[model samples]
Target chain A: MTAVASGGRVGDGSVAMLRQMIRIRRFEERCVELYSRGDIRGFLHLAIGEEACAVGVTEALDTDDAVVATYREHGHALARGLSMGAVMAELEGKVEGCSRGRGGSMHLFDAPTRFYGGNAIVAGGLPLAVGLALADRMNGRERVTACFFGDGAVAEGEFHECLNLASLWHLPVLFCCENNLYAMGTALRLTESETDLSLKAASYRIPSWEVDGMDVRAVREAAARAVEAIRSGGGPHFLEMRTYRFRAHSMYDPDRYRQKDEIESWKQHDPIPTLSEALLAEGVLTAADLVSMEEAVDAEVDDAVSFAESGTIEPVEDLERFVTTPAPADADGGRRS
Target chain B: MTTVTFRDALREALREALRSDDRVFLMGEDVGRYGGCYAVSLGLLEEFGPERIRDTPLSESAFVGAGIGAALGGMRPIVEIMTVNFSLLALDQIVNNAASLLYMSGGQFNVPLVIRMTTGAGRQLGAQHSHSLEGWYAHIPGLRILTPATHADARGMLRPALADPDPVLIFEHGSLYNVRGELDDHAGPVDLDHAAVRRPGRDVTLIAYGGTLRVALEAADRLSGAGVEAEVVDLRTLRPLDTATLLDSVARTHRAVVVDEGWRSGSISAEISARITEEAFYDLDAPVGRVCSAEVPMPYARHLEEAALPRAEDVIAAVGRLGGCGGSDG
Candidate 1:
């Protein structure tokens, strides 16, 4: 299905995708500055050139649908409508954080939004997605669960195991594989014997496809179709989103594995400018409109940083809380340690 | 009192759970048509239908992780992984996600999931199939490890486990499935937070659980015959150990002997010995004795397997050593 718009709603939707991408771009650019200043600690994995995949795919999901994301999930979290302040505070490890200062950048979780986690383990969230969809199916609910993982995860055993379970059980799950060429330092070609990820899913009898991850409209259209099929009892669907990550895998990496020329070349196809230029050509956005969007996103990100800075540290005494839900009154008495 | 086999008690518990709550479901390989590897889930599929007593492929990690997810989605899921040996394949999901999610998510999520797996070495299932690793699970922080040692507990622990907000692992000793006993008709949710005295006495405490509970009781019987009056303590809950009950028993008896099927090094028996030393050290009349399985991958031969495990004689020997009989390890 083509994303080309003919009416007011379609035109507005296209502009919204552009705005979401701009928001992610500005928010993460600010994260880099905050990380260097030590305001944000721990491993920070950015989706600098992967704005379209997160925005487009998340936009396709209904509010009732659940999302299971990987550690490089700031883009996915923001696009899923998690408050910018909470996401920023989580990164800053404050009491106002999404995980209450417990899970720094790698584990931003919000129960209200149905964002399952900000999982750190490779391929960890796929099985969780299958289970979430299983819950929906068992309860006779028609909600879909979107599971995001990287190309590197294909080698992990859970990737294959979860795929088979989802299909065998016919659960409503959309497996979105962000094929960003490399897993940390190892290139996909060097790792996967069959680099075609869609073929892997198809082997399990799930309808799978390849999507242009750099194009927001293309991704949105593909995700919409897959999610529609899932909701209509089509079981699980897989999308091999061919995308690229412009930043180093994490802040610690010098990223000497790939050539600087290769990075610069991928930057030429960066999703933000590509979508913005398309909008400008379509008269959906003017130079003045673009400037205002950038200014608005920058100010919003600035406010998030300030919110994170002013947030409180969790009291040290409450450290052991939540280890086990404090036992109920009728629970086995006097044995709790 | 009602007579029931351990296997039937487990099935009854599962049936009650499925009937009482729409959210409770059982999922695992061969759990439906094949009636479970141990036949504990027999007839559940037909009663609850395929949606509730769901069968899964041989993928352990996926099904177990799905149980965690289903629990998070407000459904109480009971996932059975054929045996403890098979559970190793899904260790990542169990250790990384199910056990850590609540704490890592800062309490935003709680996995009200029950994972039942057959544990202990017996019946010549050999090295791959037979092993007791429940103690390894007991080391985890966020999980509640339970070993249902009697017919009442076999029928009672599931409801409490399902009601528990955190992840609870029920390790049913494979050998006890055929053991028949009297279960009270009024039996309901059993308290899983404390150890219970199976047979009370004042001489010495015989500590064990699951398969080893029989051995401890038998040793207690032999000790009573010898006019020793040994008390038997069945540890139902492994994690969040009831040191209060344990110390009370030790304080009264003035001696303790821990019997476990798991090997000795860093085993649950070792933890008990350490606890008694820390809490009731002065109350102990001798060094705490341990009757753990000989440190060997369980052999297939019947006699060797029997020898490899902690038998009633081993518990008797440990007790005798506490009474100054000739022994080294104990």
Candidate 2:
């Protein structure tokens, strides 16, 4: 894992990481166009600048380990192995979607890969992640539950509660805080009395660190270290990814809260270009290699769009389904009706 | 049959659940070293140890959400909130996550979690510790709401609830903990559906559940001496309000009075009365009646607390308001 770290020799692993960031960026770029055409509806939260946080943390997790992510989690879902087609189909509210169109943009779920959800509510997934780790611990299974949330969730009571519980119970949880400055319109400094996010985790007596989120290699390295410590029975770990969202909080948000210069400054550190340039400078990635990667990502994104376009919506008659598990036949005879 | 208190019945049920399934463990505040807030889990800590009989911090949202997550991770978890009042802290997790998970996840994730909490106003516990909000929880889908009034149900409901693929909320009335009744020694898992006809009659139907079941039964006994043979119906499941049994009993009696510990407005009693009117309009000899608690936060004073709650006298008065049994011919 260290071999793929920044300043280390770039290899196939590093290139794959670069490719993942491009895939996420291209996918969400396509989503913006689809959203304009009204192909995707409801609140669309893009993780345009937070791809490193998603890909870095996710790549460090095992297939069997669980992941609980926020609404801005298209990158996490894609990196966790949910097909682009399935995610795109979900955004379009199609039956072929990952959640069968029940959970659109904010609630993507895939069971096989152990992806828990695309939770819409801030700080909502923290408790779920704690419980997942508790289950793994009680069952004697060595599995880490990586929970991703934004800076907004740090102010939530669930965040503090979950941190204490996870640490107290010695549960295997990797708390990935994507601290992309503003929690919606309110900046972190305004909401939090103490702006240092890692210090909050440290107060819970849990090991915490801050990483440059724009550097995918740094995120992956930090996440790997945290996941390793948790799996080795060292309890929960927290990594505050210092990043920024280049886009608005949602499609509905005008994003007037932050200045243009600030946005442009963050864009200068965009993860995709940062890693690509670093690899190019190190003679690890050629111009031809970068072009091929972009071409492949575009093709994949194009195919996903087509898949979403061809997908069908679920029937209205089945609307009442999944409200509750179907009651067993022998249990309540002639009672429910 | 052996005589037992409702508290012991609940403990036995918890013990049975813990013994039956390795995945099932009880997690709550004071459930371990401190026993339980109501002593419902008295000696189980020594029997099961800290791993199984886990005591958690006073973090309702975190533990409850963890229970849901554990359920998703293929473990059946029983999370006990000290009281329904305290459960408000975890309302978001319960409503948004536990109840919405199955439907929101496209049936891919089912939270097989059982959340047990004590409800009802009594013992002068004041405003925070009192109040019945099971009706509020009943409005949500993807979750099962159970209110066990009888010793048998208190001893039986947990098994099936743990077996349920979806989330189940068991609202145990705080006042009914000491109520003694004969529970069968072999009482196992009871069905999580339908209401039980505790007492049968033809004149009028007295509907109730949880803490109000005893009140309705007492009212029925008094009505018998007055030549008004009131039938007593115990609504076991609150969510999927056994409409069939409720409508069946209402159709037979023709006159009905709903007794609820919750308030009258937007109450479970209101829902029952409306359902009877909607489904069995012609069967009714008169309009449905209701007996409910006074609309005020439970006061610490015993007199005010008792007055605020529905008693047998209130049930009798409500039944009287429904008019005499003229048998639809009237």
Candidate 3:
């Protein structure tokens, strides 16, 4: 008999996974609120509908594994165990922020988790991930680098170049493509002449799998397989997790680009409620238990907000503190020895 | 002790790095079976195998970004850009990502990656292939720029660069590849933070690097014959520049002349000259002068290319204008 019957593995991990996904959902809702209030500057690209893909894939990774992400990464950073307070503070550009006010909303970074970056450039993180995997191979490390990009990145030249190098050298990398069916205003079909993204990957002989990102269990299963292959020295594996974002590409997007009915349609298959209902059907949780979980996550998010708000602004004199290390001389020359 | 060409010295550096540390590896276009664009990586694949000696597709951004990633992932990657001219393709990675990662991550990551590329004008490769952008890279922080002028530096700098905690760009003058020099099996460690005096004299200081170093030395010899003693300083490290050596030489000679192969406007020469004026303005008796290439695309014609670049004649004239006394050796 399966432990949870939610088509997932047994025991405490099941609960922990639920909590992780809840953390992302609740965290993003708070980010949206904060952005509207003018607390978090710059554009916010919340991964509301896509939380499962970020949490599930990152959960399968070891702390040593490097993570390279794109603009829409509040979920990934939270899933990687970056403090929710620091993430919020970074979004608020406070002194307690992970990047210390250097990289705002779109660029969340944590060193201890080995989170390499929150690079906003499209398809820019691909090569960095490939290189990181190459480093692991050369150093004889069994670690895998988890690179997360969107369907939009598959069209970039770095995508092709990275795939060729990763497969050619058999470097350990997990190529996680979150295909949400849209690249900013343009749909995937509009941007790519060839709509089969995995075909782009297969051209380099990389084995790939597709999963329903709206289903947590499905994402977990697909991610587990890809992660297992990479950790077990199976070379690089690709996954095209079909996902959708509940929000605009960014805060500035009028979203006249996408239809509201399509947005409402994705909400019907939303990962959070969809998974919760699945858990309820399996008798893993009740309406009351789910309500309690939601309350707990909401409280945690509130505490993070208060912490971020109470945090002080980094002194203007100390603004360029970590800009270089031993940190002397920043690009703007704010760093003083 | 064995005598090797400048390119062989570079290959030797790669071989030594690969054998000594598992973290070190080579990646670039045609670096594997082709044995490097300039044959500097010749005979490496046979020894280290294809795993260590990798060949990349013609994607500078992806491969260069991957090199930065590999460094963050804990490998000491040496990414060759085929030529510095082609480095523009991956300029985003070098300037934006690699140069900013350590500080941007709040000191969480240090790239420790070495990017090697052929630079300077020599071969009549025309407008695109004959430009030097080392000065552009040197302008950034979180990066150390090394211009390997001598065969020794070409062989020696890679070890220290691989050992440094930050990313380093090793600019090997394309023309210096064939220049041969004898070296002992064990070469001593050279500091990457200071400039070194290549030829000592008294009346004036001749400062240059990369392919221009030879021209500076030749100009010094010409000055000596013309009764003007010139001190030649080779700036091996461009960023966190060797201002100490440059200033001390100027203090002794009371005159300075910089020879740079980059364009005249907003070039490495401009930065060096500005720094000298800022730090050693009182020590100089006369205004510091510079001989830089014409501010235009490098023409492919042999005579035209020579006229467009810094030469001994140009440097000799610049030094003479800087008020170098006849053979006044200090």
Candidate 4:
């Protein structure tokens, strides 16, 4: 793990991180193609330039650690080990999807991976994360609940309430604010009176810091430290990841909010190529290795698309199935229906 | 049977829930040190300690959403909102998260949370505190809405509500806390999915719940005095409404009058009236009548507040308008 933090080994771990980022980048790129083809519908929020934060922060979490993410969470879900097939199937509205097709792009959920949701509401997941951490603390479990929300969520009242409650109770929560500059076309500067997002968490007495979100290593180091501190009973910690979104807020967004030149400027710091170049400079991965990784991701993305294309739509007879549990109390370990 | 006030029965239910399950915990404002706003959780804090009987800050959205999260995390949480008015602050959590999670997540998550709030107007607490918003909550599909109008139900409903895997909202009428009655000694977890025929008759049906159940009962007595045999139906559950029992009563009575503390426009009472006309239109001898709160903010003046809320006399008057007072079918 220190290799990940101290840049000691640009070995399998480093290559794996870059590979994960590339996988997400390629998967969402395919999603864009699919969206244009009418194979995927609903609001699709791509994590194009923001892959580093998802990869680095999620890698710091333990297997049992819980994650609650925002709508722009295809990268987070992928980095957390949710199957590409399931995510794609969910995007395709197939029953084989992660949430059984109930939640499409904005609500991807994986119970086995401990991914709570892809919450579309700006700050809705914050309180849920606080409660999850409260559960861990009360149950004598040393697990961190990492909550990922955008800068837009900072303006929501739940953000203030959740931060205060988490700090007040000494709950183990990693408050990761993905400061992607704009919140659904509303720039952070225009909406917030004081734009220093870390101060919001500081107001609740929680220790906070900032990380260059475009740099995977910075995000990993900060998240690792925060997760370690929380697991050691240090209560909640906050990290404001300074990042940017190269894509529109959603598929329907024309992205007229920013200049095209600004996107190209941010593209110079793209996490995928930047990390790839770092790995190449360290002699951890050859140019051939990078080509092979991209090709592998391409094959994987194709398989996922095929899986999604062939996936079945949940029958209308089961329309009301998951709304309430269908299992009888006697059939399923006293689980109420 | 043990005689107790509505407050004591609720306290006993909380005590039982805590004693029975290790995973069960209660959290809200003033629930611990302040012994709850209306004394429903008076001594439970000392009994269960601060861990189980959590006294939260006035952060309703966080606490309530935490309740949903805790339920998702495999803990049973009973979140107390001081009253229905304050619950508006946490409405997003309730409506968006608690109510929608299970359905939206394709059934991977079900919020096994119970939110209890005092509702309805009678104490003249003014426009802010006095309003029946339970009808608003009942409109959501995933939530189970309960309104216990009896001491037995007050003592028993919490258990089954806790046993439920979905989010259940229990609206405790603020005005009924001091109302005393005998809770059956054998009372246990009661069904949270049905209505009860409190007083059975054949001339007309008076449907009411929560704070207005007593009003409907009194109106039935008044109708009996005037030679009209009126049946009284106590709708214990507002959502997944017990349409069967209501239709049965309506079928027998042939006339219906709905009494509600919420405003008449788009209220749960309006839903019931429409349902009766839709499901049992042929059985009705006249148009369904309603005695609902006036569509005005509840005022602080006692007279104005009383006028704004539904009263037994109002129920009688509404029934009288249905031509049921003379013991002869119209």
Candidate 5:
């Protein structure tokens, strides 16, 4: 239940982390091109700059632990080990997608990985996370439900209600607040009177922490600590990851609200190069290693693109499928004998 | 067979579900210690314990969404909202999450949750506490809407609703809680996919469900005395409507009249009337008639509130307008 200590020396773990972040970044960059070329459409929200928060928090979770993420969840899905091809196929709205193409970029779902959804509504997933944890607790399972949302969710009433319920019922839930400065076009200061998200969480009597979201190591440490506390029956824990988005809120967003300098400043601390260069400086990762990693990521993205391109569109006739599970023939008007 | 109130029958159903399945639990505002706002869960807390019979805070969205999550997490949660009007606060959760999850997730996740709420305008609870919005909920695709119009349905609907592998919403008419009827001791889960013929007649079919079933039956009684035989059809399940039974009854009777507690425009009665016209248009002896609640928020005064709601007089008047009966509104 203790937090993992970081020795500040680059190792295989750091290399893997860097590769993961690179995979997310490169995959989304390819999506942007596909989206412009009309291969993929709909509201695509990229987590280009906030990759560290997704990678670190997901790294600390066990496979059995559930994850409820937001619309900006490409990084979260990739980090949670969903196959890149499935996510890509989903973005392309193909039958082979994670949600069978029913959910696009904002609604990715993979049950085997325990990823609840790519919920589009802000703060919508908090209550679900609380309930998932409640089910686990009631069943005597020590599993944690990690919920990821933006700072915008902090203003919603469900956020407060869920926090209070999770703490009051002693449910094991890890609340990850990815504060990427702005909720779409509106800045946090304009929307939230109290900008300290962790402080707001603490008001509900849950343990809270604020971490450097740009640093993968910091996010990992804080997440591990929080998950440990939750698994050890410390109730719910909140982490306010102070991060920024390097891209517009969505593909449709003009992003005219924020200054160009702000976006550039956040890009300077992009989690991919930050960790890679740290490893390079520490002599643990060579220039050759960096090139190979980039090549591997490129190949993976290319393969995913090909898979999505070849993915089939679902037939229009089956549109009504899954609206409700099919009932047994005899079960319709028959009594329970 | 034993005589029991609708409230007792519902409680027995809840008890049976909890006793049979470990995954079954009841949760909502004042569902535990407060014993439910209408006293339907009066003695449930001591019998089932606090964990299963949970009393949530006044957070409709949170608890309802939590119920959806719990259902996804492999538990059968029966969520109770005190009234229909209050459910608006959780509309996003119900529409966006609960109803859409199974389809949106490509059938990967199905919410097997049951949400129970008091609906219908009666008892002069005023506008906020009264409103028959089950029709609005029935408009949703992924949900199975059930209205327990009879004691057997009140006792029998929960088991099947829970057994369903999708979300189900049960609208319990507040006025029927104290209504007494004979329930078979062996009463068990009934089918949730059909309408029941409460009374058989040949002249016309009087369609109703939940609270309005009583109104329809009362109108039928008056019609019988006037020598105008009126059949009473209780639509148990509003969604996935028993179109077969509806058209069959209309086919035989050659006339139909829908009585709905919900307002006329875009109401379930409108949907039923349209379906009748669409499929059984040739079988009609006359244009289908409808008696619905007046288009106004319920008033506090007993007389105004009663006047705003559909009564036996409304149904009789509707039948008279259809030229199916010579009986005038009393």
Candidate 6:
């Protein structure tokens, strides 16, 4: 409900936005540390710098709308209101985590939050979102399926096919492209000669938009309008959230793709602090309040680490479970998102 | 109660599934006004309408991917490929997306989709159109492969598959679509995990599926003439292979012969033979053998086509090789 061009305002909503963003920032920063300490295994893809896109887009949706995120989806999961304890416990591979620790960080899932998955395959969630939208349409529901994929996913044939079908059928699908400059190591420019992703969707006759992903408010506003369109049977819409990932694509990258100065240049427009500064200038909350809020988030993340530490490991016997739904269809371990 | 060909059984299954569930729909090339390429979906478009009986573009990957999406979205989608050869174009969606979604998502998503494709050669359709890739799909986890050899299975497997929470591939032999038989009862809900004994015997176990089942049964009759009572086992499902039935019969018979239309080298028959050896080698008096199609692209000539597909003669010869286990007694 608050209107700020990118991170230029400190309205009543600023503190909430800052808190969510900081919570994700602290959670993933600790994740990177824990991953190094061997507390986590497998590929840990942290959404360190792209917190604005998750928080902003999620802020625009309701509780019932569906969300399908990518591997680098910790921020999205956190912003969607999946308990920090559950997300942290998932990363810790505990049975009590969102997907019962079956989904590692790259595969976080919480069905209750309507976050469909933390799909590891690039562009895999697009078709799934289209399917969810199809279900919604058939059920005569007004829910929109916001599918989050990286700019790299645009190159995948699934993306093209899904967008075409969604547009042709007038399905309520919001194709959210998180253009974080690079696709793992291959930069966006390398994949498409025309690096503008929204244009690609437009090429498919789908409605498209571009937003400053560095600014949470801009992302939120753009997402709100697009989602509103989709919810009202406006068919499908595409948004290119031009953001950046400060960390390596995953834990494996050596930061060989972009220069530090470029990172520093983008860091100037970091949504968390920039919005806090504007909020301070607007007299909504003082610098003390921002610090205290961040401190609270830090403490909350610390509690998350404690919860993850105390979380119980799934028994080895259940390892063969969930691969198939087994004899009973409903008996499949239903997600607790 | 109804005498139906394999094609009508499939059509009946489609009609029943589409009528029974609001979420179940049929989609593929020529599945609409044309009454389907093989007529397995005949009268379905007229009954279910164009929306539910979707006609897709020539793009196999796109439509198949869309079907997977629809399945994930909570719809029971039965996508037909017209023939097994065309499925290669949609392999990315089937093998990659539909098959891997469950495991990759850490069991968060289950793709409840059914893909039906006409398979095998004998109609002089040539090398490009004739293939039996059930073995390749069997190699992939997360998918259930069903090769129905009877009217009951063709009618029965669809309901359970529509209810199952994962992808299931049904490979129907194009050559057997016209094979009709007297039906006593409709199979209500069949298990996708085991095999069925179509014609029981005692001497040698004749194991086969899809296009090869008829040959196995014919061979069993031929063996009966020679006093060799060959038991026939139809492997309705291939993935969680009903090795239990295949080996159990082999253990009793003291010999086994697998008949598969797929090529022998690394075929499903090869795998079944290795499994029989591993599980029931001690129970056998002779080594297990296979009556698989000759390793070729299935030549276009009618005689060549006949040579490429495993036949009753091949099964009889394989059964003849089990001389130690009563074949010599005959």
C-alpha lDDT of all candidate models, in order: 0.90, 0.91, 0.84, 0.91, 0.91, 0.83
- Model 5 iRMS (Å) reads 3.7
Clashing residue pairs found in predicted model 3 = A127-B66, A131-B66, A131-B70, A132-B69, A132-B70, B227-B327
Displacement of residue B207 (Cα, Å) in model 1 is 1.1
Q: What is the per-residue lDDT of model 2 for residues B49-102, given as tens digits with 9 covering 90 to 100? A: 999889999999999999999999889999999999999999999998999888
Q: lDDT by residue for model 5 over A1-337, one digit each (tens)? A: 1222245323436667788999999999999999999998899999988999999999899999999999999999999999999999999999999999999999999999999989999999998998899899999999999999999998899999899988889899999999998988999999998988889999999999899999998899899999999999899999999999888999999989999988888888888888878777777778988898899999999999999999999988668778887556732221211
**Which ranking of candidates, highest DockQ first?**
1, 2, 4, 5, 3, 6
TM-score, cand. 4: 0.97
Model 1 scores a TM of 0.96
- The number of the candidate with the highest DockQ is 1
Q: Which sections of candidate 5 miss by over 4 Å? A: A1-12, A328-337, B324-330
Model 4 interface CAPRI class: medium
Shift in Å, residue A192, candidate 1: 1.0
So what's the TM-score on candidate 2? 0.97
Whose DockQ is higher: candidate 2's or candidate 3's? Answer: 2
Candidate 1 residue pairs in clash (backbone atoms < 3 Å): none
RMSD value for candidate 2 = 2.7
Give the lowest summed-lDDT range of ten residues in model 6 chain B: B321-330
Q: Fnat of the models, one by one?
A: 0.75, 0.80, 0.68, 0.68, 0.72, 0.43
CA displacement after TM-score superposition, residue B106 of candidate 4 (Å) = 0.9
lDDT of 5 by residue, B182-249 (tens): 99999999998889999999989999999999999999998888888899999999997999999999
lDDT of 4 by residue, A18-59 (tens): 999999999999999999999999999998999999999998
Q: Give the least accurate 10-residue stretch of model 2 chain A, judged by summed lDDT.
A: A328-337
Which residue pairs show collisions in model 5? none
Clashes of 5: 0
Clashing pairs in 4: none
Per-candidate DockQ vs. reference: 0.75, 0.74, 0.53, 0.64, 0.60, 0.45
Quote the lDDT for A14 in model 3: 50
- lDDT tens string, model 6, A235-294? 999999998887788787788878889989988888888777867776777777777888
For all candidates, the clash counts are: 0, 0, 6, 0, 0, 4
Off by over 4 Å in 2: A1-12, A327-337, B326-330
